[model samples]
Target chain A: MTDIIIAADAWDEDIEGSLLTWIYPDGAEVKAGDVIAEITVEKLQVDITAPGDGVLSHAINEGDLVSKGGKIGALA
Target chain B: MTLTADQPATTAPARKVVMNRAIREALDWELANDPAVFLMGEDLGKFGGVYGTATGFFDKYGEDRVRDTPISEAGFMAAAAGAAMSGMKPIVELMFIDFMGVCLDPIYNFIAKHAVHTGGKQDMPVLIMAGIGGGYCDASQHSQTLFATFAHLPGLKVVAPTTAYDARGTLHAAMRDPGPVLYLMHKELLGLGLWGTMPEASSNVSDAYFEVPLGKAFVRREGTDITLVGLASMTHVASRVAKTLEGEGYSAEVIDLCSVVPLDRKTVIDSVRKTKRLVVIDEDYRTCGVAGEVIASVVEEIGTELIAPPQRVAFLDTPIPFARPLEKFARPDEDKLLKAAMRTLKHA
Candidate 1:
């Protein structure tokens, strides 16, 4: 399984981003580099892309606060 | 240009952006494409707007085009009206919707009445952008979605967009229109990561220029059980309720009334015709507001055809209290919307 990570280096390490919503539904088939979820860090909104082509599984619920480098979802 | 579903798709890739960025991009496009387009508001130039919607515009467009006006709503609003009459398109930002009270004369008397007063000879191509809604503890003074107040007046077009896609398209459409348009942006949906985040508010918006035509109602979800009509923040609420009800074996059609002034009666009536029930959720006040207006229109069209009495979930007539819990109670929410939907279904 390839894990979808909210890259730690994308924003300031001190700020925790909230998973705004999952663009694609859980268990849907997705391709590598396809945007699957959106997160808001401070005032910036960033999209999380799939790491590989596989069935997507959500690791975090929408509106949940997410830390940098944490796994938001996984592609199986 | 007005964009419809039947229109040919552009090759431009869709980018996921917050509502504020989407608005900024639309304004940027208008400013770059048309020399007639310019911006004026308090803190718009240097401060980049209170919500950061105009960030970097001051530098990119310079002081001449991106102007910073004094904290005078009446003054700037009048100036914008005069500028529009003279063939210049001015986009004025009223920091908060609640402040409209201080500048009603200019908006109602001059800006809205210009075209009509001139026998269609003069055109008022002015766009008034304002921040509205109350999710954070901004009290009654700072947080009131007063789109209905403007909609009540004649000769003005009013629009409140729920998502980034609609925000970009509607703003484009509003800017291009020959008359004055009030574009109300809900503070909670601006994607500033303030108060709480609304994931659905952020969407994949196109980079290309397009217009989500005025006087159009977008059916966000198609269903047969009941029709839940909403605008601005309430659109998101109704959508959430619809999704939740889907799992409970109930189908609810969600209609986002993007343009309030025109009141998309046909779409709402059509949906109610199919569902045989109606529920309107509005952040605006219950009395003499969009909720009542929608229900009245639908009832006037097909009152006897409805399977059940329609329900309205909206803000209380009282001012939005300062306390968080009281504000929560006053505003239309998911629970309130769900209950209203369920009630409509039960009546049917």
Candidate 2:
């Protein structure tokens, strides 16, 4: 399975910010480049988008902390 | 421009007192005094302020003035901007300053940029209030002091009152000021220690809402040896260090940038020029912070006046941790501030 793993900001040593909220849920089909989730790193917030089109699964839930290069979710 | 309470074409009067209570009291008085003044935010009303700040205010002023909103900082903050444009003074409180990440767009895009966005003349009278820093075990989510986020913005007037006296006074000024005001109340400053406990707070505050005036800096302690520029709560710590520095025969000037947006650049630059040395203290980390801006401004305007490179005594570049020791390690204390000051003295 090809995994679309979302990475964190370049400056984040660890994935410290949470996935604020997900615009899409697990098993949801999404188009490429669709904003799937909101991420907060060092008080800087950015959106995590779908890298590819397929069944989407969220690796982190709302308020759940993740690390840099950490998989926020996957499009398989 | 004085707006009246509950009556049209009437004017509210002004009075003086400690700073902390000024904003809420002004909000209360303004809401009571002005029919246009209303408050809406997360846990604002019955929670009597998210910090029990507006305690017993709703009872006296009614729910309209003391509104309790859903846990939607972005929604309410934006709504506040809209309300102000619609002719209401809405005091919007973000649950915590760290939560700015959730709702900054409305503040930055809609409120702050509105005047320019509207090509000037349209004013937003929204006063966004919330406390930065942790009361105790608030940990990362609640503990961050992110005034630098607001300070970095051009249109937002960021006010951090170190004492109750300034808190109340500056708040009064913010409410009356003709733009968006970020009125941050520190969790520690909530109980009114500067002028004694709440209820017995500075009797100097008046029922008549007055203006504290924006873009003004307060020189808490005056000295000729060195100049220290501190923004918000860090100003308090800077004041403490200044006292110790005085004991060491070094006189320092503690300048509080009451309104960060309209930074009292004259007060700061003039002080730096006189002392020939400068140290900046900010709660945010060293990089891209208020200190960075202050240092740049001083160097750009009067680089020749420096005794040495201006020093920044700032929080270590790290997230505020849960442990006391770790938190202390991250934050700038008296020792670090004094050390930075002493190092700057070498330049002179």
Candidate 3:
């Protein structure tokens, strides 16, 4: 399983999590660097990308506040 | 051949540089000159700073000197303090000034008090740099220029530079000084080129390094009808308002209090004395902040001799709202400063 992690910069002192949208749904096949979600932090929208090519599984639901390095989903 | 009086004097043309590049150059100079000076902050190394102020530094200086610390503010702050005490001059970046709360003890209690506590025998030469201010709707937590709060504590030299020139000079001074300094940088003025552009702020900085004395207040514009005093981004705002009011023949003197702690009382008081009317515009909370301090200092120096009570144009005593209109209303701008100046000048 390949876990999709939020970029480390997302948890810098200025940012706080606001999960905006999930572009890829659970069980959707995605390419290794495909942007799977978009998260809002301190008024900036950041795209979360897929870790690998495989079936997608949601580790955390949409609208859930996420921290830096926290796994948002997985490709298995 | 005699130098012709008719010919224009040939002086080196001052190079125009942005605030971030000026800062990066300062860091480059410091790193090359001193072995003790190093930087540590989250995203500072690999990411070249969240605002790009520290870009290209990690490559030049390498990871040892240009470090990327964990997200724990307290942890890195304490480390910086420790390193400074051990004879290393560390330039620490607190991603945002608001996060100072997370590392309050080490910063205010330890690093600030170290010199006095040791009877001047020990000095903590640490520069705590942070991004401050709001306009792009980052909202309450991410936006704030709390220089006054840090200045309130004894032994801390709090400075906020509004232009590329001052940023370079003040930053060099902060790094060299043998004590703790809270160096606040406004995010909007980082010279990102992508964000808000202030041509005046982004230009006119000299290529050669120099220092703007920390405690001095710069008279951005000379006037006599009313005095408009401000710090950080508001300094530019005050200058703009001064120009706008010039159409009506109101000569507004704009004073930039470059360093808050070593409050340049003489400059501020002198301006107020001349104008007989003062309007202080601060980005910080209105109550118990620099605006009040400026007013009190002026009144303390001259009692009942003023033509009008000094006016304060600052953030309302409320948390900055997320919405644009509310934030605009809450924060002081050209319109607010203009009105405050007009109100103060009414009795003059």
Separate DockQ for every predicted complex: 0.21, 0.01, 0.02
Q: What DockQ does candidate 3 have relative to the true complex?
A: 0.02
Most accurate candidate by DockQ: 1
- Candidate 2: segments with Cα more than 4 A from true spot: A1-76, B1-20, B135-137, B192-208
What lDDT score goes with residue B199 in model 3? 45
**Best TM-score among the predictions, by candidate number:** 1
Give the lDDT of residue A8 in candidate 3.
Answer: 83
i-RMS for every candidate (Å) is 4.6, 19.3, 17.4
Docking class of 1: incorrect
Per-candidate TM equals 0.85, 0.73, 0.79
Per-residue CA lDDT of candidate 1, range B1-348, in tens?
333333324442344667877898888888888888999999899988977778889999999999999989999999999899888999999999999988999999999999889999999999999999898898999889886888898989999999988999999888778999999988888877775557688887766687888999999999999999989878888888999999999988999999998888999999998998999998988999889999999999999999889998999999999999999999899999999888879872
Tens digits of per-residue lDDT for model 3, B70-173: 98999999999899989999999999998988999999889999999999999899999999998778889988888678878898999999898899889888
Per-residue error (Å), model 1, residue A8: 11
Give the candidates in order of TM-score, highest first.
Answer: 1, 3, 2
Poorest lDDT segment (10 consecutive residues) of candidate 3 chain B: B1-10
Q: What is the TM-score of chain A in candidate 1?
A: 0.93
